[model samples]
Structure formats: C-alpha cells, structure tokens
Target: MTTDQSSPISPYLTFDKKEWAKLRAETPMTLDARDLERLSGVIERVSEQEVIEVYLPLSRLLNFYVGASQALHAATSRFLGQSENKTPFIIGIAGSVAVGKSTTARVLQALLSRWTNSPRVDLVPTDGFLLPNAVLEERGIMNRKGFPESFDTRALLHFLAEVKAGRPQVKAPVYSHFHYDVLPDKTITVDRPDILIVEGLNLLQPAKLPSNGEAIPFVSDFFDFSIYIDADPELIGQWYVERFMRLRKTAFRDPAAYFYRYSKLSDDEAQATARHIWETINLANLKANILPTRQRARLILEKVQDHTVQTVHLRKI
Candidate 1:
C-alpha cells in the first residue's frame, strides 16, 4: 500500500487569466498608494485593487515565513549555546532575464522593510558577480556571458559565507546597467541587515565540481528561502522587445550608454537588434540554464502573457 498527499492549494481552480484580474478588481484597496511608491524603485502602474487582493495576502504570507525562519535560527543558536549573532534572513530570487525578478525583489524589499518589526532589508543582484568583459575576453567566454561558467562562483560563494557568518561591513561589488559592466573598486557595504534579498538569473544553480574532483556547495546552499519567477518564453521575448523600445528613447540616447548605437537606429532597426539579442543570448540562457533550475525553487509564481501572475506553484512537502 502507498499514500498520496500532494495536491494544489488555493481557491485557484481555473485556467483563465481573467480569474486573477477579476479577483484583484473585486478586492478593496487597503494597501496605501504612497506605501507602494516608496517601497518600489520602479513604480509600475499596477492597479490598486490588485495590491489589495493579490499582493497584500502574499506579503502577509512572506512575513510569516520570515518570522518562522528567524525563530528557527534562534532555536538553533540556543541549542549551540553560542553568543548571540544576527544572521540576515537570506532569500534567493531566481528567474530568466527580463522575467521581472528585479521588480519582484525590489517590491518585496520595500514591503518587508515596512512591516511591524521593520527590519533592514537590502537588495543585491548577482550581476555584480559577473566577470569583467576584459576577463571574459581573456578566457574566450565574452559571447557566453550570462552562463554559469562565466561567473566568479568562488568569490560569490565566499561573500555569502561571510555575510551569513554575521561579519560586519561585508562588501559586494557593484554593477552598472548603463555601463553594462561591473564598476571597479565600488563596493556596497552591508552592515548587518535584518534581511538580504539576493536576486539573479542563476542563483538556483547546482554545485558541480570539475573532473579534477573537488566538492563545493552551491550559493543556493546559503538561502533560507528561494522563489522562482515563471513566465512563458514568448511573453518574455515580447517584454524584452518592448523594454528595448522604451530604452531606445531613454538610456540609449545617453552618450555613455553601452547601447548608444541603438539610439540612432530606426524603430525597425532597434526591434531587429533586440530580437537578435533575445535569440542569441537571453533566450538561449533562459532555456538552457534558468528554466531548469525552477525545480530547485521553494515556490514558483507563474505568470501569463499579460505579465500578471496567474497561479503559484509551491513545492510539494
């Protein structure tokens, strides 16, 4: 005899995306508008009702999880009878490029910081861990930039180790989107944050040592919780093109922008360039690496082509 104990939870029983939209529309807007504006860097024009319905409950859920994680940590410390140390509650957010992981991380950091305990929340991106273009060229990996092998894995791992050990003034390298490169010697010192949200394309990667035979744990090993943003490939591709079109009129016009050449391109020319990048780089990385790691996430937020979340898939117990 065997037993089966797993099934979907939530009132979600429909395949239609409108179900969420309708539900969100019906819910009263309780979350303050100013609250959201201050919490998020990118003030996306999401409907007020959606926050009241969907995100408010989600925020409450995450708060509970964070509190539980802290309680568990304290219990472990008591068992060891060690001196009190504050280890930041680390969360890993993993998703494909252009899948809104950055947006999600920013929103969560802002909301979590405003909770009753009002812990200090810091958001960091793993793009800063990317090797310099010069270094990538030296290793002949300039073309395969966002792949797992392109990162300084050991350095990233060590940084997380020190942060988890509650070391004071832990510094992380900074990456600039305008420059499209890691800023040399510029570091963000994290001073004992109550929560650290690490957002990246490949944070859920599995550890694999070379045939040279060494064993090493992955960065995901340090995460107390992890979430994977999910969306269809076609939707992400469209969003990439749209975002590129928007940037063509904004950042691309800057003389120092890495994409300054795009500022001069016609609309069609810019779209073509964006398509080429999606096909050659971002999409390829998504299919080959990022999508596979969804299996490792503790929770998955599945989205529809309209970019609103449809349903959430929690890992089976």
Candidate 2:
C-alpha cells in the first residue's frame, strides 16, 4: 500500500506495491518467529518477522485507549454509584478468519501488559464459547462453525456481564485449536485487570434477525472500545486457503489430529480443496456476517496482500 499524500497520517497507505519500501521506514520493528515457518507448510516466507514493525505502534496506540477507557469507567462509576469500584475496560476485536486477528490480540496482550499505568491486559477469545461438537452435530450445523449462531450466546453474555460488574474473578470457557472444538471442564480465569480484550470473528456482528419484537443483548454491549481488522475479501480468502493448505501438510499429518483424515491428499488436490472450503464456507461467512460489522469498530486496521497494515481508519467520535 502507498501513502496518500493528501491524508493527514504519515506514510498514509495506498494500493501500491512499490510504496511498501517507502512505508517500511514508518514501521518500528518486526516479530521473529521460526516457529511460524515450521508450522505453516504453505508459506514460502515467514514474514511474521514483520509483526514488530507492524504491531508495535498499534500496541502503543491501544495502550493509550485502554488508559482512557479505565479513566472513563472510573468517572462513570463514581457518578452513578459513589462508592463502587470500577471494573476493567473491555475492548472488542473482530475480524474474518485468517486475517491475523488472533495474532493481533496476543501481541496486544503482550504490549499492553508493559504499560506502566496498566500492566494487566487480559485477552479472551470467543472461540471458548463455541458450542460443543456434539451440539453442532446434533443441530446439523457442524459445517457452520464460527457463524454467530454456533455459539452459546447467553453464556458468553453472562461472563462478560460479570467481568463488567467488577467481579473479583471471572471464569471463561476454553477452546482447543487442535481439536477444533470447545474444551470440556477447562476454563480460564480473569482476576480483575486494568483492561480486557475480547477477540473473535463474530464479536462485532449485530444481533440475529429479530423474531419477535424484543431484542436480546450481546457481549459487544460490554465493550468500552472495539476494533475491526479490515482486508479485501479476495486477500483474506487467499490467505485462508494458503494457511489451510499449509496446515494440511503439517498439523493434519499428525495422526492424532482432528483433521488428520485430510492429510493423505496430494498437494495439488489439497490446495484445490482448501480453495473450495474458502469459497463455500469462509467467504460466505465473511459476506453474510463479518463484513457488515466494519462500521461498528472504533478503529479499523486495514491490511494489504503483503500482510502489513496499510491504513488505520478510526471512527470520528
């Protein structure tokens, strides 16, 4: 992406490949991960090394918001209820799959924790609230995983409410990426923190189409701030397909892996299947649900094909 000279932001990103070199000067550092190379079977380059330069500024920016949110929370709590302690500031992060939102959330957690005023930033992924495989299978929606309807919405809302209400400790469900399912009997706890970040694909989606007149609240209502990672649909699809094909050659090869059955396919055939899944499942979900919620974000990080953030679109308050 090339910088828009007209735009106020420095090194404004535009749709030009040559601009990347010029914009590299604006980036601070890059994350180094040999592990990403080992894990990804399809990727030719481990540009996760780009993470530092790409996300460090983002983390610094988010730390500012986290502090502001906490200050606002304290003011509101005092104004409404004189003696009550304020809860942590909650930030919601939403984006389509393979857009790197998970990695973003983790990096934010690490960076936000380094802030002097707020050294504690807790991250919770909505994957934990996904319905068990049995339930999805029973409902014949096993193929619709990551869709808004596949989660335990009420339970997720309840957990967020408790966290917002200043509960000393809160427990959240946990999910396993390897198993591709929400784990049973395993949970993560959040002792009151300075900030809480909730990440998921459908986190910013509006409530389901109404049936009757009354509307039910969703977890996003608890967010003090929200972020949406923006990307072109074609780019996201390509990334997803690339990741899937890579995983097939590695993770799927593990005999005990849930997707092990698909590992036997030839590379060419596996790549074709990955593309098919992206078109039929992921791309459909992005259009039907996620893309529509971009307007809901307080800030949007727009990325290009090179896996670097090009522009940051912030909502005018």
Candidate 3:
C-alpha cells in the first residue's frame, strides 16, 4: 500500500491497486462476461480483471459495513425496548460525467446482490430526478442541464427520506436518455430492499442555506457510505469526447434520439461538437461542483489511463 506522504496524518488510508486486490482473496467471483456486457454503460469498458480486483474487495467491505450497521440498529432498538423496522443501507456514488460512475454503480449492484446477506440490493440514479426538458427551457437553463439547479432537489430529498424511513414502496421518476427528459407519470417502484445504491454527479455537495439561515437536508445526508471516482481532468475530457463519438455511431443514430443531429455530422465535425460541449458544459461543471467534493467521500477510487483504478483510499474510522 502507498500512503500519501504529503498528508501523513490524513483520515483516509490509501492503497495501491495491488494492495487492495489482496483483500478479496476469499470473495468469490460470480459474474461473467455476458453479465458485465449488460451492466456496462456506453463506451465504458469493465473487464473481468476489474471485477475480481476492484469490485470483489469492494463488495466484501460493503458486506462488513452492512452487517455492522444492522447490529447497531438492533442494539438501539433493544435499548429503546421497542420493535423497529429494518431500514435499507444506502450507498452514494459520485463522480464527474464520463468518469464511469454509472458502470461502477451497476457493477456494485450486481456484486452486492450476489452476497447472501444483501441479495436484494437496488440501484437508483439521480438522473431521474432532473427536471424535464420543458421545465429546464422554462427556467432558461437548458444549456446547463446537468447542473445542480437543473435537478428537483426537494423531490430527491423526499425520496431518500421515505426510503430511510422504511417506506414499503417508494417510487422514483424514470428518465430516458434517448429523449433526454424525465418521463411524465412514470416511476420505478423500489420496495424496501436490504441495500440501495444512489449514483449521481453532485450527491456529496453541501446543502443550500436559506436567507433565514435554516439548513436544508442534502441528498448525501441519507448516505451511510459514499464513493468518489477520481481521474485526471484532461483524461476525463478525452474520454467524454470519445464516448460522444461512439454514441454518434450508436444511440445518436436513432431517429428519436435527442442528439440525433450529431449522428449525421462528419467525424471531424462530431469531434468538434463534442469538444465544445465538454469545454462549455461538462468541464465547467466538473471544476466548479464535482471535484470540490472529492475529499468528502468515505472512499476514493483513483483511476489511471485506460480507465483502470490504480489507487484506493478508505477513510479511517
């Protein structure tokens, strides 16, 4: 394990890839290539090696955390001399766009579900909480679609609150990437599961205070554990552009796609358009909002080129 020499007394314990992989020796590998293909996002690569080295250890660690949390809740219930419902263990995953946050969430969902204790793990993405396209246009922030302001923050908070309160069935709005909008009158029901994984770009951000100085609950306040996926800004930009180009040949080619225009453009033209979007939108969002929350995560997975995690930092208790 390689410790951060600069911050010798920091709260997080850092480990290189090799050191982290050793922690998963007893964990079984249950996923195959076909399973990975279903879980992977567009243009994102997740090899079987990554599943064994990175996700297997992560799943084992999560199992420990979940068991500890359940024990704590049970002890509290006994102390109060009352029966209490078993609340779901929530995990938040945050990262910049194109940093493979979705892929990580999906992979974790699969791995965690295979565990005997947390077989009913569920995944919820914050994209569904985003305001519809018409609402964004009405607010005159269509160009800033992925910004914090573009999300229905209160709705997301309420959803998390209900989940934590042990609601029998909670519904979340459904988001369609092809239409690039939140579907009206559509929702995905989440029954009380053993675990829930919430993935997004800004879940770790602090709450916004009102003029009265009252503090509102942030989405991350409901998270028992959180992870931040880290990578170089320049490399992320490159990956974003590459994914955009790939989509031009795939999803963007669909006639109903929101970004269908890019599919008809020449390769050079498409590349230019991707660069513009990254520079004007995604990159700006990353610098101002996402990167600032890196230290807030309980764990950080730092990736090198070719999208492989080279280091893992786990916050010490």
Best-performing candidate as measured by lDDT? 3
lDDT of each: 0.78, 0.77, 0.92
Worst 10 residues of 1 by lDDT: 1-10
**Per-residue lDDT of candidate 3, residues 1-317 (tens digit):** 65565586877888988899999979999999899889887877789999889999999999999999988988998999979787999999999999999999999999999888889999999999999999999999999988999999999999999999899889999899889899898898889999999999999999767889777888889999999999999999999999999889999999999999889999999999999999999999999999999999999999887898989999988
lDDT of 1 by residue, 24-117 (tens): 3333344477765654432234545545544655566667777887788789989999867988888899998888888778777766776665
Candidate 2 per-residue lDDT, tens place, 1-317, comes to 43445657533334332333343444444244654444232443335544454455566666677777767767887889877575788889999988978766776676567668777888999999999999999999988998888999889999999998889779999998778888898999988888898999888876766788687786678998888888999998889888887788888889888888779988888888888888888888999999998777877778888766767655554
TM-score of model 3 vs. true structure = 0.97
Error of 3 at 253 (Å): 1.1
lDDT of 3 at 125: 90
Per candidate, the number of residue pairs that clash is 0, 7, 0
Over 4 Å off, model 1: 1-31, 34-44, 209-215
Per-prediction RMSD in angstroms?
4.6, 4.9, 1.4
Pick by lDDT: 1 or 2, better one: 1
